[model samples]
Target: MTNLGKWTARLAVIVILVLAFVAMLWWDPRPHFERVRQDHVVHFVVFYALMLSLVLSLPKLPVWAIAISLFALSVLLEFVQPYFGRECSLSDILTNLITVAVATFPIWIGKTIRPSDN
Candidate 1:
């Protein structure tokens, strides 16, 4: 695909992910799960994975920019949670960072294995 097309796709994915995260905050499932501890971790894992996937999808985006965006988004979400009756925790931010790091490792490996001709 062309660069513009790729960028458009990545932007769309980021919007969808933000919307989904907001929806989750507004409509939590912990009440139905009956085990808040486990449910919270599950939610964190799923959200982190989605965030990591979005970060990895934009191969042309700088790693530092991706990391900063991820951190900023995490902070934004935390600040917004109170409006939706949700409480944010530092653990969630840590989990997100770990997942993003794990997702980025493959990209790092690929670059190291195939250095550019330039």
Candidate 2:
């Protein structure tokens, strides 16, 4: 397998860190959309990208391990959010877990449709 190098992994981690900091610290001005929870959606999308980035950067690791690790991190971060003055939500944690797992779907699709160099 071709390596994307350690830098891509580092970049992914950096993006996740920055987004998490903003997400946990800022009081969301608009937290919903027509009864759907916006925060939960944000958590889902953000974690999805995070999982993909991590796997792209660390292709040697199993996707299940990455998903589990990132899900745990999401849960741990939620626990830590209260210290930063943000309310923790089990719903959000669940959303994070689900989206992280969904991250593997795109990779699978991409591989299946990817063109052959030969």
Candidate 3:
């Protein structure tokens, strides 16, 4: 990756972190979309998008390394969820890993289909 791509990828990581903080920590009076939030389909789709973003942001990293890091990250987040007045479930952990694996299919197939930096 170019210097700009690395910086952009790092910025994306920060954005994802911020979004995670908001999604998992902050409480608000607005409609919480509980149904979708709890749905396995949503879990699959959201984490798939998330892993895809992570891969896109840091393509220089080894694929297995990314997968392992993300797996650990998910476990850590689940462990943290209880403190934030949220319930943690093994199902979520399973969903996360599965989604991440499914999401990375494109990368596993061949060279990644990256947008031109030109």
Candidate 4:
């Protein structure tokens, strides 16, 4: 694929992921009972995917910067849930951060071990 095609594909995926994040966080209409036991698991997986997509989508940027930005976005989204008929939970923020950490830790470690040629 051409450079332009690769970037366009990445941009499209990032946009879809961002929309998914917003919709899931702000507009989720699932019953509380259904989410009680599995909420953190959902958060962890979604954020993990988001983290990996972001790192791949923006390769020129530092991984630490991407992780920090994801954390900040998570915090912001969690805090504003109340206005959107959702209760904000500290646990979600913590889970999101933990997910980011888990998602990025291996990348950081691999770089440490291999020291990327770039």
How do the residues 3-111 of candidate 3 rate in per-residue lDDT, one tens digit apiece?
A: 9978887887777656655554433422256754545655565576577677777677888888888788878887988888776768778988998888677778656
Worst 10 residues of 2 by lDDT: 27-36
Question: lDDT rank, highest first?
Answer: 4, 2, 3, 1
TM-score: which is higher, 1 or 4?
Answer: 4
| Model 3: ten consecutive residues of lowest lDDT | 23-32
Ranking by TM-score: 4, 2, 3, 1
**Overall local distance difference test of candidate 4:** 0.80
Expressed as tens digits, the lDDT of each residue in 69-92 for candidate 1 is 877787788788778887776766
Q: Is candidate 2 or candidate 4 better by TM-score?
A: 4
Model 2: clashing residue pairs? none
Q: Score residue 59 of candidate 4 by CA lDDT.
A: 67
Per-residue accuracy of model 4 over 10-110 as CA lDDT, tens digit each:
88667768765764675345537666647777787678878878776776789999999999999999889899888888888999999999989997877
Query: What would the TM-scores of all predictions be?
Result: 0.57, 0.64, 0.61, 0.71
Candidate number with greatest lDDT: 4
- Give the lDDT of residue 117 in candidate 2: 44
Candidate 4 segments whose C-alpha is farther than 4 A from its true place = 1-34, 115-118
User: How close to the true structure is residue 101 of candidate 4, measured as C-alpha lDDT?
Assistant: 94
Candidate 4 or 1, higher lDDT: 4
Give me the overall lDDT of model 2.
0.73
**Which candidate leads in TM-score?**
4
- Mark the regions of model 2 whose C-alpha exceeds 4 Å error after superposition: 1-36, 106-118
